[model samples]
Target chain A: MINKTVATLEESVAGIFDGATVMIGGFGTAGQPAELIDALIHQGARDLTIVNNNAGNGDIGLAALLKAGRVRKIICSFPRQSDSHVFDSLYRAGQIELELVPQGNLAVRIQAAGAGLGAIFTPTGFGTLLAEGKETRHIDGKDYVLEYPIKADFALIKAHKGDRWGNLTYRKAARNFGPIMAMAADCTIAQVNQIVSLGELDPESVVTPGIFVQRLVRIQHQPAASAA
Target chain B: MNKWNRDQIAQKVALDIPEGAYVNLGIGLPTRVANFLPPDREIILHSENGILGMGPAPLPADIDPDLINAGKEPVTLQPGGCYFHHGDSFAMMRGGHLDICVLGAFQVSRRGDLANWHTGAPDAIPAVGGAMDLAIGAKKVYVMMDFLTKTGDCKLVDTCEYPLTGIGCVDRLYTDLAIIDIHQGQLLVRELADGLTFDDLQRLTGVTLTYQPAH
Candidate 1:
């Protein structure tokens, strides 16, 4: 059923409980919900475990959440070459937990959760230090390694265009984790630049259908300097 | 010794590839090496989208609409190639199963530090992708990059200018001018790509390149 579109970011992101397992879309700040993130920060939601492809850059994207000391743990596939001062500080202080997976594994793990798969095996980190301590299983006389699934309580995404009913369209690399995270999250919220009526979006262009999305908020752009 | 250009450097690197190895060719210039792998070699090409035994870029008429690489470029699979679930393909990557991962580098430090993720911009996307995983995960990490960025700053440095994808993960640095290896905390100048001298390499590199042909 098409639901009421909320008026403001805070209202849309309200009830985003503390310690929510939030799966944020975007590969390195692309296609991230800037408005929802700001709302989450302003709301002071703490102890979040964000499953993101990339944790934004500097103070611009999800990295801001880390900088704000809002997140509790991070489960991800990509670890930045450039270390965030906030992340390093948090890590050194043991204030937060970090689990790093391979990029490919990151994508597959979330998909596995959405598909209800418990685990799968591959040859990724076989002989290296990565294989140490992990259960190594053999199938058909071949060495296969086991990797588990990752899921989340909320999925926050940025869409180039969306409908009040929650259908979404993402542009370019921005589409990276949004669709899959939408499927894996319990409550999916989309912060969009353009909100249109149903049937306005081309079926081919709709990456995440409305069925997966629960809330939609339209974001009005504010200049970078004025953004919190 | 010959004066090697980008193509020659690509061929030299391709020549070093052992038979039956599983290799991932990175984007841009490194992608060209797909043409140089010996056809008779029993190699398996792995693509991130879950294809194995990939042949090379396909002919226009032979293009299968369904076939492509991770970069979204059209490609061809070998005669016996198979396509599996994309999840399965990544399992091969993160599981540390690949023989080699050929990648492009923005910067490589002298101590074999790899920084190929993002330039330092506040809003710039932070972090490296599968590149980091492949860097540490692959048995061998081969970095393919020009010796110098457009600003004439050498990409290989004492400390990386960009973000680091992996700590001490790079094994070999293949360039248009020379090939370098990291050993005992020193940048060992292995072999010049061809016609390029140690001094020429030093002139281009910001970091010191130690030459010990006898050692």
Candidate 2:
């Protein structure tokens, strides 16, 4: 039947060991899989290395997980924001580690891992501090720095709809990192608003194919106020 | 001397954008350029978080938490706009698909090297974001910043002291006192603020300036 549906958020996040590299899909709060993150928090995995666009916002979702002392490190582009006080405080106290990569490099490196590429030469951070200690090349009078792929142990993502086969679609800007994170991880767990029949999802419109996604769990759409 | 205010500087930058150009305005002062874009021209705005043809801020009634820009602020989408994933969105920037990108900077060297992302302070939390990609990949990189810091330090200098975003990437610099172009390592003054002369602009800037006004 090729059904990959999981019963509960806890079951979906099961077997996540300590020190696992996890990719949480989101750009700010847009596509963040808050429910799955909450479940992972309750599941009590420690020393996680998270990858996302921002650190956290206003003590919820990723911030809550951080507050629970579950994360050891984070690799992201922009970690500082107005509401990023949780990360800000922890970072100042040196309780957590941070790897600040250029946003384009962060995206393409994850894409490279998913695409099965060894490395890529990008001009983004050439001759800058970020490119220091990295291999650089001059191609056709242009300088480029070598960047490697970033793979993950698991990816937690949010989607608008999913089928039993695990095919998924996302809404608006909420689709930011979900598709790529799914492909870059060994096991991609998705939380979807609705679970539809196999034939209900149009084959052509599937953003994350069933092949990339491993498990799908349906979540009720809670009001925005309760999301935090 | 009467310097150009923030909005006036943005308006000046907006005027230089050609018709039908695809532009990415960095957060902060550069975002104001969107409001002054020529109404007759069809300029496509790109947000790094995966949106193209971006419009202005949405009304409170129409705000959607799912739809936000790179700054985490709610925004609307224009007709013919589309959403994409982060990978494809960054690809658009790094692949040279974008025509212009306006950014804010802390320091810009005479050679057009950009230093905006970090102050190199040991205590500061460094966040690079897409600034480096936009600086190097856009066909034209325009920088909008104050000419001097609050402490009276010049931002346009012979050399940048802070960590660089990109090397030799900036094309034009729009500051409060003058509009300058970086041509083959030379700072060419294109226009000065009202009541400000070339000598006045030179005295304020940290580097040598050449007087080359646009005809």
Candidate 3:
């Protein structure tokens, strides 16, 4: 078993040196760790390889890293190319690299990575770009595509509330990426709006088990910060 | 009933929306389409939150506390509308089951890319919600917004200045001044609001626009 140590969110996350791989919990922006992202931005760390759902809305979450020119490559389900076409321009300019993963396949990959599976077969991308350049296998007279597991050194996520024991609850869209990523990272650093004591949370309300969390930080959103 | 300005835009966008087409109205203004649906036509409304038989937003007094859409907003289910798991709803979206998805836009490019989630503000709540899935998973995407920015700059741009949500996924645009299509990497004017001309739209836009007058 891996040895354990205690650290604050800042200290635990400081393990992420330059060129570290990070798996952030968020689908688009729903489950993104805004406070932690802000912390990373303030640190101005660079050369990150991030795995996420949709290279989430820019300059707000992971996009802040993009804006700060910190991330070097991104492994995600979709690339950001809408309003800010600069992402495409940057990719074309080789400013950063993108590894496109199918949403279903990506979800399964994170699951497999967390489970310590080297790779697995999925039917999600039987005939799309996801099928190209990957191992293929057939079962029951049909084709299946091979997907590799992805785990990161650091996992950044947000929780609606967390206990000192590390159990968590997510509110609404924030629920999407948190559970999946929390289980898949080597170390998870969560920024929660509130922190309660152990056993205070109902069993059913704990979306992510305490086992996955290494450290928790209570970061209150100042009311002015959340105003639309 | 007095219509909210955003609701008026939703109604205008749905006025000629064809019958028998499966449409997914986005949250917020687009959600108002359910209230404006024409009884003479059968336009199936799909809510990402997992209701297929979505009725219009109920009158406040008629609201059922139990009935809600994927957004968790209270809704009135239509007679034929049914509730399902969110997974099933996303299946309908990712499975190419939608005919059209009308979403609000932060910025739309000449090529019809949509960027709606982040406003690029330094400190704000960053939530994509379902915009990414809806933006890319739907069969076709349409954006609804006014022609110019609050400062009066055109939102139709040569390139989106905001962080993008989907690339090459948008097809049509319904603005207060014009109805346009993204064709071959250009915004082609197809129709216009009353008293609006092609030149007027061009003056209000920041991108190079092509005009295709309706016959």
Candidate 4:
């Protein structure tokens, strides 16, 4: 059995280079691989393209990463919020680039990459600016716009529990984008709260099978702090 | 004339939602409908961020950092509520599993064209999220917005000049001044705020509206 565990967060993110396209798994601060992101910020990887649900909720976690001035581009669904001052400034100054994908399209495009599909036509953005320059076809008398797979070089994810083999389960809504992002990346590093011995995680309960995971690191919990 | 306030508009939208309906409420004004839904009715609310069976907003202390709505505000889930991945949730949306979707709009054409996401303003930030999906995916789309912009321009237009979110998708238009239905390529005035006359609505709307009296 391949032992995929890494001893430290820095070791887990060791291979990430500048200009890497990284997929981050989280909705707001929940299910974010915070320690790993901090490690990357410390590692000083620059000109990176990040994919996530939102730009970053507050001035911590992924948002902190953006504020660090390391990201070159962001591809996400919702980018601006009240707490996203870091992104707001960077975006307005043209210091960063944004690929604003519709939320469902963002999900399925990642799913498509994992499933080995080339492109999928969705009716979500048919008549909007989102459909501009995309191939449109009328199927069954309904219009759909073509969207391609969104594959990433690396995926950083947080999971509630993981076994030695890397089979994972999530807590509540924390599972939002982790499973799909895990499958959509070339190398997936998971930060889990706990790691159980093999066979500890029920096969039926595993949300992300170990096959999609490449490495794992454990994250110690701290008292919940005020959100950024 | 006494026009409906924000909550009043939300209450009117809630009255049209039937029991046991699975509805997705857009952010902003449409989110207010959740507060006005009849308590006896078992309407399953959905948030596009992957939560189904969504309940009202949570108090400050009851806030769970993990649970949030499409608007990214903390929310509570109903007893049987569950969450899923964004892909599955969107499949439920694009596959037409939702009973209705109430959304806020910048403009809704008489032909039911929806243009809510962007205004084409040079300085305006574009955030289109799931509006496009919900606009076209839900079984029916009910729009809730002020009848006119803060600048006092009527939003109910003959044609949408802004970029459209969906083509011919709006089924009903609920505004502060009136509740109108789109039928047979015509705008039918169903209910009007008290102290407003048909001619008043017509002059305010800047469009032709047919009044259908209740039986």
**Which candidate achieves the best TM-score against the true structure?**
2
Candidate 4 chain B lDDT trough over 10 residues, lowest sum: B206-215
Give candidate 1 regions above 4 Å deviation: A140-142, A222-228, B1-101, B104-128, B132-215
Q: How should the candidates be ordered by DockQ, best one leading?
A: 2, 4, 1, 3
* Candidate 4: tens digits of C-alpha lDDT, residues A1-228: 678988988899998999999999987776677788898898889999999988886677788899999999999988877787888888999999999998889999999999999999999889788889999999999999999999999999988899878899987677889999999999999989899999899898899999999999988774263232
Best by DockQ: 2
Better of 1 and 2 by TM-score: 2
Q: Which ten residues in a row have the lowest lDDT in candidate 1 chain A?
A: A122-131
**Poorest 10 consecutive residues by lDDT, candidate 2 chain A:** A219-228
**Candidate 1 local lDDT, A92-167, one digit each (tens):** 6778787766566677778878778899675444433344578878788655568887888888887668887788
lDDT of 3 by residue, A50-92 (tens): 8876664544656767777888988876565343344555666
User: Candidate 4: RMSD over Cα atoms?
Assistant: 1.5
TM-score of chain A, every prediction, order shown: 0.89, 0.97, 0.89, 0.97
Task: Indicate the TM-score of model 1.
Answer: 0.61
Better of 1 and 4 by TM-score: 4
Per residue, candidate 2 scores C-alpha lDDT tens digits across A47-96 of 99999988988888898999999999999999998989999999999999
What are the Cα lDDT values of the candidates? 0.72, 0.92, 0.70, 0.88
Listed models, DockQ each: 0.15, 0.77, 0.05, 0.68
Q: What is the lDDT of residue A191 in candidate 2?
A: 93
Task: Point out where model 3 deviates above 4 Å.
Answer: A1-9, A56-58, A81-86, A222-228, B1-215
